[model samples]
Target: MGEGIPMTNSTDVRQADAAHGREMDPRLFREVMGGFASGIVVVAGMVADEPVGLTCQSFTSLSMDPPLIAFCPALSSVTWRRIRPTGAFCVNVLAAEQRDVSGLFGQRRDDKFEQVPWRRGVSGAPLLDGAAAHIECEIAEIHPGGDHEIVVGRVVALTGDAERMPLLYHRGRYGVLAP
Candidate 1:
């Protein structure tokens, strides 16, 4: 357990001025973002004695001094609704061979954890087995995005395995780094 961030009513929507007047097609935006490779993670948390999580690729380290990390989850995420009250979560950095795990959590099924192996972390979050690394964190802040919410977490505990190879996603496929 670590310091928890206070939950807001979510009525205050953060808006910003448009970057440019040029309009871009939604499909082209998705295609451009897909071309950029990113690491994937399964952000899991336990609430009411149940595991809740969803596959995430829009996660990244935000700060080092405060030990913060950020992940973007869709505004209508069912899994987020289930775990929001917990105020804590674990980021399981997927290894190269955990493609099946990714597929299992990518769906909107309630029994997502039925076959997954994991244990609770220090922050009461579920740490997935065989993950390349684990980062336990407390919810710090949340900002409203276009269609997703940017969740910032303050890291409490973390560990990694140097031998494990991370999985990457690019252009709609999973891949491993070349030797």
Candidate 2:
């Protein structure tokens, strides 16, 4: 029931059949979406006494009544593979000073936690130190997205520091809030 309207200079609307039924190029889609600024977070979990985590940009609070949050993980993420079986995860909301932490978790490496400082949360997931905040959760639901999985988590704990500035990403670069 949704179709694009003609661009009559009234507002910026493109036709649904733009480029004659050809799908949007992946590169262009990525470039367009990169214009959107997003906060960075690390979704961490414990696996056999080992900590596993991955950087996620797509995370949001889903509900207030039930206290739910959601994060998207790529289909091929090895960290997600390990986290899914644990039944619990912690979201470490990165502070502006944690760009190095985000870069570490965003990669594929066996010693991801070698230099990281963390402690176990009630959910058994590693809670990164120096984060702006932390949300401890238990897995509640899993849904499929085009190239990622939508993981819904039921919030079990919440903690934050208002003085810390959040780390943000936009156009392939890290940013901080304006003063």
Candidate 3:
């Protein structure tokens, strides 16, 4: 969260701007965005000693030298606001069998991590026990996109077990990497 950001109604101006209407139909936009295959990831952080996570497929690496990455969390996503203030978060790249794990984190229900197990990472965020890969990050910047925020993070730690294939997202469903 940034200073003086009117959290009360983040969508006020965007709705007014929408009087001009969408440049692309939302159905088309969904199809296009879905066409771009992405690895599934669970983004988690502790907010007031409680762990919260959300499944995200909109993550991308922004820079390598400075070790930065970004993920788009929809402004309407309640999970995002709850976790963003924690200052640090962990990105757990899922393995092929983790679609259920993704769904668990993606839901609005409470205590998503109750059945899953995790441990603290160097950044003090939860490192999901069996992710194919994990990256710990500190919030670097926040840029508001039309309906989402581009959260930029500076990588502070990384760990992985390279043998596992990443969980994949395509065409509105989860898939496994082809061998």
Candidate 4:
């Protein structure tokens, strides 16, 4: 066999001449990012008094003093467009057993809440039942991100069961923490 080419480090790879530089493929980027485990959440709100929601894995706690949280929604999300006008939402931190719930909301369906049980929270957003935690908030600010919107929420109410295990997503699949 012929001699193999030398392996290049990240710095060298990144600094390669434009014509010879390697660009990240979207599919590979997604696959690499999928290695990171993230808690699953359902971001829900009422649009014209109708419940609208979408499954999300980009939720995060931003600050303690101000009680701010954030989640990224794809720019093309119709549910997000509907919820944006409401100016409020509820983040339902899914429990380990709520994989079906996440799948339901993740799909393109109008009657997502037909079989799902939920109740209106302080902000009038639908707080899903059996969630590990619920965070009700009013939209604080929305910043533009690449192909997504970074929505910040100012927390108004919060409740949850600490004993329950959170639903997790990794490598394009649902997972739960091992004891």
By lDDT: ranked, best first: 4, 2, 1, 3
* Model 3 lDDT tens row, 39-139: 98999998888888899999999998999999999999998898888899999999998888998988898878888989988988888887999999999
Error of 2 at 81 (Å): 0.5
Clashes of each: 0, 0, 0, 0
Q: How far does residue 92 in candidate 1 sit from its true spot (Å)? A: 0.5
Q: Mind giving the per-residue lDDT tens digits that candidate 2 earns over 17-37?
A: 345675555665676678789
- Model 2: how far residue 45 lies from native, Å: 0.2
Rank list by TM-score: 2, 4, 1, 3
Worst 10 contiguous positions by lDDT, candidate 1: 10-19
Q: After superposition, how far is residue 167 of candidate 1 from its true place, in Å?
A: 0.7
| Candidate 3, poorest ten consecutive residues by summed lDDT | 5-14
Number of the candidate with higher lDDT, 1 or 4: 4
Structure candidate 3, residue pairs in collision:
none
Give the Cα error of residue 8 in candidate 4, in Å: 9.5
lDDT of 4 by residue, 14-119 (tens): 4453338566556645765787899999999998889999999999999999999999999999999999988999999999999999999999999999979999
lDDT of each model, Cα atoms only?
0.88, 0.91, 0.87, 0.91
